[model samples]
Target: MSRKKTTRHKAIIDQLSVNPSMRVSELSDALGVTTETIRRDLEELAAQQLINRTYGGALLRQPAEPVLSERHKANVEERAMIGKAAAPLLKGARILMMGSGATTVQVAKRIAFEMNNITVVTHSFGVATALSLNPTIEVVLAPGVYHAGEGAVHGAQTLRFLSDYSVDWAILGASGISPAGPTDALMDAAEVYACMLRQSSRHMIVADHSKFDRMATARFSQWQDIDVLVTDIAPQGPLGQALASGGVDIQLAG
Candidate 1:
């Protein structure tokens, strides 16, 4: 490939990383390239399995996760607030289900410190270890294929294991949520979360304000699917009202 072609391809990948989906014409204009050039670049990227070609443009083939160390540092205050907000609701639940995310890890820590005699089921190694230190909590790790960078296990085997047992409540973390629904960057992650939601009687979403209105590559569930949403602050505007009208309880932490 020529220098220009390589540059165009890199630009397309960057755009798709941020937006997930885009039209070829939009990408062409954004990159200051001709439509035919954009099309050729898209074809090459698709061939390499870096992207999936749609009718007009392409979607990123795999959603990327930040390194676990880096992810642990982002949004510290917001995650703590979310964890604090979620802790009270965890009381008296013998079997607690938690999802994998930085915020959810904080929730695990909070649960370990505040609650006792709880059996925690999770795909997050971080959550399992965090709670293990408490000794009061019994951690049940679901078996599956581990994704190293994300530090979470996912796949059909994991889902099947989750289906065998039901939990009193499930606390979930999401990449983004809007009026439309909760979404994840990766489809596999979404699938695992969907299984957790299905197996649990009560569902709660733990997210920060930054997640509001952001879109992701795949959707796991709508706002209605959750019984409660715990965040640092209440969402403002139409999306917040939509969630309220839909009978989803909102919990905001100080």
Candidate 2:
């Protein structure tokens, strides 16, 4: 297929995935293509078993599982900056709750050395293990079904355990973000993060700048849900304005 045809097909797939039953005219308007062209792309996607043809447009097929580890390595510096920005918030925290992510792991290391009287609650093996030997800090692991690839505990048991106590602060990471909200690449992770958010008083999101423009499979929280957004650089333009308007505090790390 030609480049134009491929682009049209991808657009149709994205739209159908988001809105399973769109009219051809709606798809055309959204993609800036003629209705006939939308129909052609729908037919092509249906032929590839990518979608199910409806009366007008198409229904989305199930998407493939995303590779989480490869994505973690994509922006190392930004994550480090986010870690540095988030560290200061942990200074006075007595009970800290952290979620699983490379950035959160960095934050864990930063707090391990400086913070005392700290009781760390986490679903991440990385965080738990990192602070395991810190005599000044106490580490509490939330028990649940562990996924090796993600190296985090998740499921009903974890959520149940987390609900039993509230924390002073919760630090989290997102797979992506836009003006609407922050999202996760995995549904299971999103569920666990939601539980963490509810069990903490101060909700802090530690996401790198790259997460700002992307989209993901499962949305966990809106920008408003976050009390503070600790990122490497300040987000500019409409996204930044939207976050600010939503009362999300922003912090930039060098």
Candidate 3:
């Protein structure tokens, strides 16, 4: 690719990383290129399995996690407030399990800073590493194939390891949530979360406002399965009403 084309490719991927879906015209306008050029770039990206071409746009591949460096850029304050709110709930718990994602990492940071003598079991390398900074916290990593982009482990081995230990609390994250409940963009991550839910005595999902009403590739659990939800904003609309009626406790950080 020429220098200019390379620059456009980088910009396109960066935009998709943040929004997940975008149209050719949007890319064209954003990149200062013709629609035809943007379409060609989208086709190239799709062929490389970096994105999925749609009718008028492209979306991030279903199984792919956003580059970790970019994940933290989307929702900063909301995630932090959520972490602070969630930390107190696990205050007395001895054994805690954390799932992978930016919000969950924030929770781990709060747990490490505010709590003491906690044992954290997780497949998320980010969670484990963050908690390890506190000597009072013991971090146990579940074994599995590593997904570097996600900074987590997931596979049959990880599931088996998680099944062996029941934690006092499970702090989880999600790619999307609907009235049907929390779903994940990737099946492997969803499967691991299902195990995490089962192997823990209590569990909750920590996500930001953006997750509401979005649908991912797989639904991991029903609304009634998890005990609580921590988010920046209270969900709205009919789906929100349905989730509210479903009996899971909803806690808003903001």
Candidate 4:
């Protein structure tokens, strides 16, 4: 378009890089433009997912893992099938540890409706809320700092509380799973899942095929730490070899 408009777009991105957020008035004043122009700019940037529009301003978007709420809506059928396939493994579980994840939330739904008379210790509020629907299942929430973005808890207190107890199984989900192992997008989340696996007799990872071979921020569990992988598809290539050689059972939900 015009040179002025080109310059304005660059200015908007640059200003956001400096302060990460600004009001329409502030940007308009700085750019020597009308408030309406700034609003239009913001609308354009927001449409590109470059920033999040606020009531009166905007927040610069930082690249990171997808929001938990949005992730719940993705891979719905695959996660549901993985959840259903994981049920037989929990057949006789007494006390268990579950980590926070969209796929784990699906597993929690099954336990809440089908299973009975089991106690679960977890850091995810979503899992707790789901399991709470069943009066017979006791839900123990781990003490920690609540993370609104993840709808879970993670901190020193959570690790300390979990370390004190042993459980029949530790069930978790992963953002990525490669030859190295299962991983999470957040360091705190990775640490929490690792700790849960260590304290349980059997460790199970519930993830869809989308996670296969993808590497995330942190690898939390080695194959030795994982007993079963409940997924929607069979592991292929190096992922398949690693799991087999490492003695980790892969159960395909399909």
The local distance difference test score of each candidate is: 0.83, 0.78, 0.84, 0.86
Best by lDDT: 4
TM-score of each: 0.75, 0.76, 0.75, 0.75
- Global lDDT for candidate 1? 0.83
Query: What is the clash count for each candidate, in the order shown?
Result: 0, 0, 0, 0
Comparing 2 and 3 on TM-score, the stronger one: 2
lDDT of 3 by residue, 132-179 (tens): 889999899999999988899999999999999988998999987766
For candidate 2, the C-alpha RMSD (Å) to the true structure equals 6.1
- Which 10-residue window of candidate 3 scores lowest in summed lDDT? 59-68
Per-residue lDDT of model 1, residues 54-148, tens digit only: 66766666446576668789899989988888999877789988889898999998898899888999999988988997898889898889988
Ranking by lDDT: 4, 3, 1, 2
| Model 3 alpha-carbon drift over 4 Å, by segment | 1-65
lDDT of 4 by residue, 92-152 (tens): 8899999988999999998887899999999999999989999999999999999998999
Q: Judging by TM-score against the true structure, name the best candidate.
A: 2
Candidate 1 vs. true structure, TM-score: 0.75
In candidate 3, position 3 carries an lDDT of 96
Q: Per-residue alpha-carbon lDDT of model 2 for 121-200, expressed as tens digits?
A: 99998888777757888999999999877789899999899999899898888876556577777788889888889989
> What TM-score would you give candidate 2 relative to the actual structure?
0.76
Residue range with the least summed lDDT across 10 consecutive positions in model 1 = 59-68
lDDT preference between candidates 2 and 3, better one:
3
> After best superposition, candidate 2 residue 162: deviation in angstroms?
0.4
lDDT of 4: 0.86
Model 3, residue 180: C-alpha shift (Å): 0.7
